[model samples]
Target: MHSNVVGGSDRIGEIIEVRGADGTPPYRVRYPDGHESLMFPGPDCVIEQGSATAAAGRR
Candidate 1:
């Protein structure tokens, strides 16, 4: 499985650094603009598993 970043969604940030927040995956996302936020992995974000994002990377 892999992570997917959707467009029109809240832009976490560029070079987004993810961590576990409250034990949640993608706990936090840091943007290049010198801003960071806590991500809720599923509710606020989702994992994308398909050919579209086959890089097997993160958001």
Candidate 2:
């Protein structure tokens, strides 16, 4: 997820659990720093599909 703060970098996290019906919003995510939170994504968030490797920028 993109940081709301200016000059802040984006965050990377794994979707450990899904709270939304039919895989919608409100995901349970675990970050690399070992923190987890329930997230309802905003417009800055983007969901990418493909290989396990990560990449940035919009589609």
Candidate 3:
């Protein structure tokens, strides 16, 4: 996800849980830095299927 904060770089993380209905928004993500957050992605965010598996492989 792209950070809205000025000077913040893009964030990469794996979706650990889904809080939305029928696999919608409000995802629980775990970042490479070992921090997790519940995210309601904005317009800057890109959703990719199977990206979570790829992210896990990188860890």
Instruction: Order the numbered candidates by TM-score, best leading.
Output: 3, 2, 1
Q: How accurate locally is residue 58 in candidate 1, as Cα lDDT from 0 to 100?
A: 40
Better of 2 and 3 by lDDT: 3
Error of 1 at 31 (Å): 1.0
Backbone clash pairs for candidate 3 read: none
lDDT of 2: 0.78
Per-residue lDDT of candidate 1, residues 1-59 (tens digit):
12355444454343244466554465455565767776555555445334536434544
User: What RMSD does each model have against the real structure?
Assistant: 8.3, 6.1, 2.7
lDDT of 3 by residue, 1-59 (tens): 88899999998887889999999979999988899999998898987778666757866
Candidate 2 local lDDT, 1-59, one digit each (tens): 78899999998887767788998879997888889999898888877653544423211
lDDT (CA) per prediction: 0.48, 0.78, 0.87
Q: What TM-score do all the candidates reach, one by one? A: 0.32, 0.73, 0.73
- Cα lDDT, model 1, residue 35: 72
Which 10 residues in a row give candidate 2 its minimum summed lDDT?
50-59
